[model samples]
Target chain A: MRDNGAMQHSARRDDTAAQPSRMQSAVFLPIGDEGRAELVERRIAEAITGGLIPAGERLPSESALARSLRVAPVTVREALVALRDRGLIVTRRGRNGGSFVADSADPAQFTAKRLGAMSRVALRDLGAHYSAITRACVGLAAARADASEVARIRQRLANADAADEKAWRRAADEAQTEIAALSQSARLTREQMRLQAEFSPFLGLIGQDASAREQQRRAVLAVLDALERGDADAAASAVDAFVRDSVALLIDHQMRLHRA
Target chain B: MKALQATDAPAAVDTVTAFFQRGVDALGEGTRELAADVASARAEGPLTRAKLDAIVLPYAQALFDRAGVTVYGAGFIAAIGLLNDASGHLSWWQGPRHSKLELAAQNIGKEHIDYSELEWYRVPVSTGKPHIAGPHVDYLCSDEYTITVAYPVFVGGEFIGVHGMDVLLDAVEGELLPLLSGETEEITVINAVGRVLVSTNPHRATGDPVRDAGDTLTRYECEGLPLAVLVS
Candidate 1:
């Protein structure tokens, strides 16, 4: 296991909280067996929408991405082509040129498309995976996070304007990611952040609904309160409930959009 | 030798230390020379990106080429990062099947990349000392575990920025393993922060904390480098 000291990738208080790809391995985990261009496209699209590889940051070279993902370089080229076509990434040439995530990526645009395409099972599966990692992470935080650090996170939990999609998403992201960093296990924290990126597009949609945002805010605070009280099980359950509620909301949203 | 005793540390591992000393010394040598080159270029005119690239690119790529496959394996010392606000980050890296290094889009995008916040960039600027940050993921290009050796560049006493090389962890393991392998005692090489860089012991992988054996182990300092060999 990588020590937490070795895991400090950013100068930020929550190293996992950065938009840039601080933990490339976690975000760029290999795509084993599935070599389809669409799968590659989907993987990168999620990373782009989720903010693992933030806007304006250059992507790894095609060959490098292929090597890490264990796919053909041509496959990566194809994926890049798709992402470029969708206006998610733009590629340039010359000394300081490569494919960069576009400067203004509306995560809502990507999420709306994704939710419509995803089957109910896929949505639930993603939720289950994310909830499992977040639960483990928060439980560890409750057990290991020092009181001062926990308090610092508590202070930073901004009161997000629920009606503003961007404001609510940003606040939710910062709160959840900083709390995950408190786990003090760099690997777990990085993994949780990456999964959060994949989960963000769906979560971003919930910010438009005031009640949904309030529910998420309370669930996150409940987890934080549990952590402060040193109740590992309570923190885990709180996050589980949070994920379950969000996934159900997303599925319902997806159905309504399809019906309309 | 005096420094080792002054710190009340263990013996100096000449052989092991020399290996890193050579690499770091070479990396430092380039930046020093580049600093002089930049100073002269300024004397002639303004230091434009083109002007800087004309001098920096060829030299940095040559350094990568000279490092060769033996020490670096598949992961040659990655592109040399020339970072400063004026110059931004200009990387000269080995592209796919390329003979010499060429400028690659290793954070070439002009927006959203805050180079100021990275430890490798932060430490040298803060202390004016060469810093090695590693056993962390490479956010620049490759997604592998990496070690970045960075040195500050000063032009006419003005802190311009830094020039550094990102060395892959596996390449590091390959370089140090031969001398360290097959030891009866556990001999692990750790970075300045006490994270294992490489180890003769199979269990202690890179990034694992070096556990002190409580008087059972002797710590040997690697002169002039932020590294030590722990023997138990």
Candidate 2:
């Protein structure tokens, strides 16, 4: 029994390994010898996409950011320029002069473009990849999460509301992240955070629909019920179903957008 | 030293495996792009190192960024480079690669960084599988402590080259050493041959052979690579 459990755990981890190989074209970026600008750009972009840096927030001045990041001022300037070029940030002149994240950066458009470019096979493969990690995570959480962890997840799920697309998406990420964290595996949690940061902007579109929101709620409740009972298999299955349903919705939505 | 706890072994393995797995995933993405380029004849016939750099380096950079991994360098190597140009072996390195100093020092025209024999390249080529080579010094490349994760690239049944990345030894230590949960217990990540990759002990650093021979020690094989961890 113990050996089986170990094997299952390792196999699930391996699933994450396989998914990235298939996701090759979706996330490539150019690296330059002077890496600081690119590094700063990605960090800022992630913060914005992850909602840590809200839309319309003023960024620190070029020199200030450079000092903090320990990069040359030119590097910060280059990063700001790139961000501006992408319309992710805007620079204001005069006393109010500084870079600010654009209001409604519309990250969804970018993510949707990438998703729309992928073949159905790639999309399904990605969906399976996410499902496997999440299933493993929730399974371990169901069997091992402490009272507080379970309660925290339950609280997050209960509080989730789909009235606003941004809030709902944030809640979804928080809920998934909480569940993944319950496994006490940093690797799983890190990957969860990355996936949410990369995909939530696009997934938020699906949450804007009432029926989709209801289905998501049902899935979350089922997983919560399994966790409450310490049923690892049930928790795993619930998460799998939830991810599959979400993936199907997203793919259908993407196909429509592609056709349009 | 303390004996391994069954509970901790899995986490330790998970941490190391995740690091290596992410590298392979990035290479897989790069290989796909390179293969597509080759098929389209976009880069055909006597592909110069500079041409290969322009064509493939962006994907490598993207992988490095998306994964948030720190590495000394990462890029692809064409096998046929040796038969043609002198500097063909080192096809790509991250960023504005092959800085003038490195170019001058490494003697691109005369010297050969013969990768065909390196375990990282050789194992993957032989098995037609991905392999992790060395937590040892890469004198030919970084001249510092590093491990190379390599994947073989094949097009039309022809072995074109290998896509690879080099993770600094200190970075691996920084990433893997803190996974040790106990004060007295030690964790050492090892390759299939039991060469230490990262360890909680400074004396048993990267490239040092694990003395325990992986026997009587709680050894857990890292998924996705023929590597294991000895938590003793």
Q: In model 2, which residue pairs have backbone atoms overlapping below 3 Å?
A: A29-B62, A32-B95, A33-B95, A33-B96
Q: Across residues A133-182, which tens digit of lDDT does each residue of candidate 1 receive?
A: 99988887776555655675566565456667666666677677667756
> How do all models score by TM-score?
0.61, 0.45
In the order shown, the candidates' DockQ scores are: 0.05, 0.01
Question: Looking at model 2 chain B, which ten-residue stretch has the lowest summed lDDT?
Answer: B101-110
Docking class of predicted structure 1: incorrect
Task: For model 1, give the TM-score of chain B.
Answer: 0.77
In model 1, what lDDT does residue B13 have?
A: 60
- lDDT against the true structure, per candidate, is 0.67, 0.67
Give the runs in model 2 whose Cα sits over 4 Å from its true position.
A1-34, A46-54, A60-70, A93-97, B1-232
lDDT of 2 by residue, A1-260 (tens): 99778756766776677454534433333444757799889888766654445678777678657754667999989999999998889899998678888997655665666667878787778777777878877776665555544675677667766776666665666676666655544456666555655556556667768788777778877887888787999998887877778788888888798889
